[model samples]
Target chain A: MSEPESDSISKGKDGLTIHTVSKDRLLEFMKDMKERGFNHLSLITGVDRRDYVEVVYHLHAMDRDEYVVVKTTTDNGVVPSMTSLWNSARWDEREQYDLMGIKFEGHENLKRIFLPENWVGHPLRKDYDLSNVQYINMDEDGEDYATFDQGDGW
Target chain B: MNNFVELNFGPQHPSTHGVLRLRAKLDGEIVRELEPIIGYLHRNAEKLCELTFYADNLIFFDRMDYVASMLMESGYLEAAEKILNIPPPERVLWIRVIMNELSRIASHLVWAGAFGLDLGMLTPFFYCFAQRDYILDVFTEVCGSRQETNYMSVGGVYQDLTPEMIEHIDAFLQSFPKKLEEIYRLFVKNDIFISRNKGIGVLSKETAIDYGVTGPMLRASGVNYDVRKANPYLVYDKVDFDVPISQKGDNLARFLVRFEEMRQSVRIIKQAITKIPDGPFFNPKAKKSMMIRLRGDGEYYARTESPKGEFGVYIVGDGGVKPYRVRVRSPSFKNLSVLPVLAKDQMISDLISISGTIDLVFGEVDR
Candidate 1:
């Protein structure tokens, strides 16, 4: 984790190191990082790059103060879930899937978190439809569901 | 018939602070499992930050952790300033330290009062609020608003502390600790409080680290990682303060850790107020309009010791007035993730005791 041994890793001027891993290697790289004492999975987020979504991981070493970013882009919106290495990734990955529409391959509950399960396209995508109006209402089971029909309105 | 009864704790209950909903499975009076269902207050905050100008984004954070608005503003500003690469003068840094410490105390005071209410002790809530009123007065004098104090700006604070404001803070500092001592004697030493909180909902150190718990929750579990002590952003390294920790990893341990933290915050403020120098508050180069149209092309993650765990702002700037992407690493979100593990096999009444110590603030949790 100290020296950037491969071309995927680059250090920023502000001492922030960003390592780009392929989607297939994310879980393996994360397992190695956790073993090396980068046990804190600080954050997991995604950015819409128009053609693909780039997933970012902010990892921290608890014993020492080393913060590093591990990134991988997914054109098909699929990345191996790292819940095996750190359970903290569960909710964070759910958030990314909810907002940026990234798919975590092995996530047990890979469902929308913030928005309802029946909502339209992911809202954080760059070209997400803003003009389309949707509504939320409670069902007989007392669960909130999303709908597009005007009858679901107030 | 089902062996376990299904119950919904809240999206609107007094004990469960600010709109958090938990689905719990109960067998008789024991909680078998609990799943926290959040997003009752999710208002698309992160998405809005992307659309907002750098100048206007600070206020948006005010509503996130409203009880500790100053700390939230400071957390975001710490990241924004790093991206801008324009550190304010020496006086402003000290000012930030003082205000941040006071904010921490104020935030903890609110928690103390609410915790008392959760335990059905009404008198301590009033005493805690009375002490908190004094802290809010100082914030109102320094900034214009008490709860949503948009005092912090990029590169500097909006205004300097006047002499009258300084006197008010001094008076508050001199008398507040005595009142805090009264609160400690009333609650911490009370046999009933101990019986209610002791050894309830134990979260092991391994589980805490696995869930990325930070702030008092992490410290209470014996992991000593305070952003101030570890990273020393601002004048933290210059000022001397202790990071209080507990090894018990239980509800009472979290309570004791936070109580000790408030005392340490007082220590930090007392030193910062004396050491603060006279200088221009803002960096002259960072103008209002210039900040609005700022096109800083870089990314930085600023972690601040917020009242809640490791509150962070991860900013990605792309040569534009608005940030390309902004994500908040909210501590409550992570802290709440540990509920099922902790609440397993606990009594139903202990739910209040456990969540009270977990210190759920749904504004941050849902945002």
Candidate 2:
């Protein structure tokens, strides 16, 4: 699994090595990366590309203090989860799913972390309607519910 | 029939600290499974940063780690400056080190004091807060704010330190170590505190690395991975200091690591003062007007060792005044992700101790 991914490897202007891999091979590639001492999963972010969503993973080797950015593009906004490799991915993936609308396949509990379940649309998306303000109200069970009508809230 | 009691730890409880909610399933006093439900304070900070110019995001960055606003501002500025390719003058570099260290110490004071209150130690809370106010006074003198000081800019600082301000800082630096020693004795030597914290919430090195827990938490596990020492930035290469660590990896170890870090900050500030040179602090090219219209096309992640951990700001610019995307690698968010691992098989009371050791800042976590 640790073979030279020469075709996918490219250097960004930021001076970090980047590996651009397909969605299906991402998990295996990451598994190989973890084996090669990229033990620390620094941060995971998803950016809207208008047509397709690009997911970025910043990995670091603690002993060597080296870093690499792993990137994958998904037209459907679904990528394999790294939760199996790193426990911290569970929350980071959830955040991406919550805001950027990128779904992590095979995640344990992929739920909205920063917004209510009834939230209208992913706020980070470029097409997200920011003018339509959503308010929250707590019911008898103390669970928050998102509402579009202002009167229905607090 | 199962006797698992479901509990809501906090959306409002004092110990949970600042709108963080932990949904836990408890079998008597032992936690079975826990889910941390956040977003009460999520104001779409990342999304907001994407919409505004890079310079405009400084205030928003300050809000994320309000306790250590200067550190947040500095980290964000570092990344933005990298893309803009603005290397500040030597004097600005030394000033950055001084301000960043003071911010680290102030943040640790808040964490130490609030942590003591969680364990019902009230006197330390007042002592630590009173000590923290002096640091805030220095900040107020610099930027006229007690907490959220908008002092840092992209290439340099908004204002240079006056002579009176430097004397104030020197006086505080001279007197603060003895005060920190007093705070240390109050928490470290007490038998009750030791019994509560020692051997509790032991985070192994592998687990700490896997979860990306940086700063004192990782150091507590004997991982010598400080961003300052590992990849020195902004004159950190010039400063002399030790990266204190312990192999115990317990709650007390984490406490000692941060407590020691406060003293080290004092040491760094002292060195920075004498080494600082006289020069223009602000880069003329990156003035306010230029920052508003500054357009860069590239991506860079600038990480700094903030008080709590390794705080990084990743900026991707698309040849526009505003950044294409801004992602914050919040230390607390990553550290808090391993809560279940730390809280597992411990008494419910120990949960507070573990969390206190972890140092949860919900603004950064939820943002």
Model 2, range B134-252, lDDT digits (tens) per residue? 99999999988988788998889989998899999999998899999999999988899999999999999999998889989999999999999988889999999999999999999
Among these predictions, the greatest DockQ belongs to 2
Interface RMSD of each: 1.3, 1.1
What is candidate 1's lDDT per residue for B1-367, written digit by digit as tens? 4789999988888899988888999999999878888887887788888889887898789999999988899899888877777788899998999999998998898898899899999988999999999999898888878899999888889999877887888888999889999998889778989999988878888889999889899999988989998999889999898999999999889988999999999899888888889989998767787787666668888888898899989888887888888999999899989888888899999988888888878888878
CAPRI tier of model 1: medium
Off by over 4 Å in 2: A1-3, A138-145, A149-154
Give, for candidate 2 chain B, the lowest lDDT window spanning 10 residues.
B288-297
Residue range A1-154, candidate 2, lDDT tens digits: 4464633888877789888999988898898888888888999989898999999999998999999999999999999999999887988899999999998999989998888887778988988877677877888998777867534422
Residue-wise lDDT of candidate 1 within A3-122, one digit each (tens)?
Answer: 533238777635788999887777777877888889889999898888988898999999887999998998999999989889999999999899889999999999888877777788
DockQ of 2: 0.78
Maximum-lDDT candidate: 2
Q: Evaluate residue B208 in candidate 1 and report its C-alpha lDDT on the 0 to 100 scale.
A: 94
Q: Candidate 1: list runs displaced more than 4 Å.
A: A1-7, A138-154
